[model samples]
Target: MKNMKISRRKMLIRSACLTIGSLFIPISYATAVNGNRHLSKGLDLIHKVLSRPLDVSISHLNKCLSSGKIDLENHEGFKDYINSLITVFNGHHHGEDEILFPTFEEKIKGADFSKLKKQHKEIHPIAEKIKDKINVTDPSFDNYEEIRNLLQKMNDLWIEHRDEEEGIVELDMEPLISSKEQIELNDKLSKHGRDMSEPANLILPFLIYNLEGSDRDTFTDDMPWILKNFVVPIIWKSKWEKMKPFLLA
Candidate 1:
């Protein structure tokens, strides 16, 4: 149950990062920020990387809910995916809260991050409710319906908060920070996220399973050399193989 709650929070943050990645700050705003290509490219890559998994997860949940039956095999598979999603999601936000937000706050004057902080606090209970449902060992279609409702509610709140945060960063914050600083911050946050999500076995594979073609290549390129060449291939292969079916299907 504790793990499930943590996973739920992680999923929420993962979705939020995807939202941030997809945001389109104005061309004028980009120009005004001294044209930080790193920040722009980094956000776009992050979106591309995370978007597929999010879409796959939501689609799978919807299918399970609408199918009117829940096979134990499928239920267990979904639980594993949820756990992986939780890890990545939590890692992303942990990076933001600990690395990005504090750093950004210092650079940008009179910026009030309390609201965003409050939103994170508020979101956890909603995520916990959905997680509780997902963690049920014998979930039925009825259980799926309950979970679906909870997820819908979570999505609404999360989307609003995520969009607002992105808007703040793009419109208000980026202008104040230098391009080099933004790039360094992005790197630190990315590293922090990967470190926090370690064991790399489940999280790396789950992320890869959802991505394809160019998006997969971009994600792989962004990975640390050892993780891309060795850790994923040599260390996590077995775990990934077991979980791949659920995520891909």
Candidate 2:
């Protein structure tokens, strides 16, 4: 009887320890068995995917502006590059507004996305102004300073918006949503973005151009084998190369 009681007590203690230990597991790691750890992991992939292109675009513009003279021959190239950046930026936020945030709110009760939505609306005009400036401005050094100043303002606003949005998603929403659900939501968001944006021919190349080394590898690894093997090599490679001159080194 005494031995049986001791054994029972040990079993209870072991069970209690496991119950407590489970609570201490990081939210992200807690879903390891679900095979959605990639989704639960930090938002680094999303951040890099969205922000790297913006950073490259802004850096290229700044480098050109620093010289105080726009290269007339490459002026149209620069405009195209800026337009591509704007397209990706707008497409990403549109996906967040229409798909990602809505899904997040559904999972997290009492979630307030009004302020974030307002920020999106506020930045639209600034983005449109930059797009308009790129389209209408002459390819001369004459309006270089004006365009440079406008781009600088747009960059500042965009960075602020990006940081805030990331904080909301990573810090606030990540803990609330399960890893499996996040993976599913991420897929939905991506699909919605692809459906809403320009054709993959244009967007994919720009995304590829901005990513390098491990980021590039991870992105390509996630793509369908046919896209990575065929479409990227046959279609997007040249497009990326053509835009290379307007992008940062």
Number of colliding residue pairs in each model: 1, 0
TM-score of 2: 0.74
Report how far off residue 177 is in candidate 1 (Å).
Answer: 1.8
lDDT of model 2 at position 84: 71
Candidate 1: worst-modelled 10 consecutive residues by lDDT: 24-33
RMSD of each: 10.7, 18.7
lDDT of all predictions: 0.60, 0.61
- In model 2, the runs with Cα more than 4 Å from the true position are 1-43, 246-249
Q: What TM value does model 1 have?
A: 0.71
Instruction: Give me the displacement of residue 217 in model 1, in angstroms.
Output: 2.6
Residue 55 local lDDT, model 1? 56
Error at 128, model 1, angstroms: 2.8
Question: Residue-wise lDDT of candidate 1 within 1-249, one digit each (tens)?
Answer: 999999999778555533332221111111112256455444444444344554555666687666765656766667767666656556655566777679877877788888887777776676677667788777777777776676666566667776777677777776787777876776576656655654455666676656667655655554456565655555446556656665541
lDDT of 2 by residue, 11-81 (tens): 78545533332222111111122244444342455456556655665676667677876666666656767
How far does residue 160 in candidate 2 sit from its true spot (Å)? 2.3
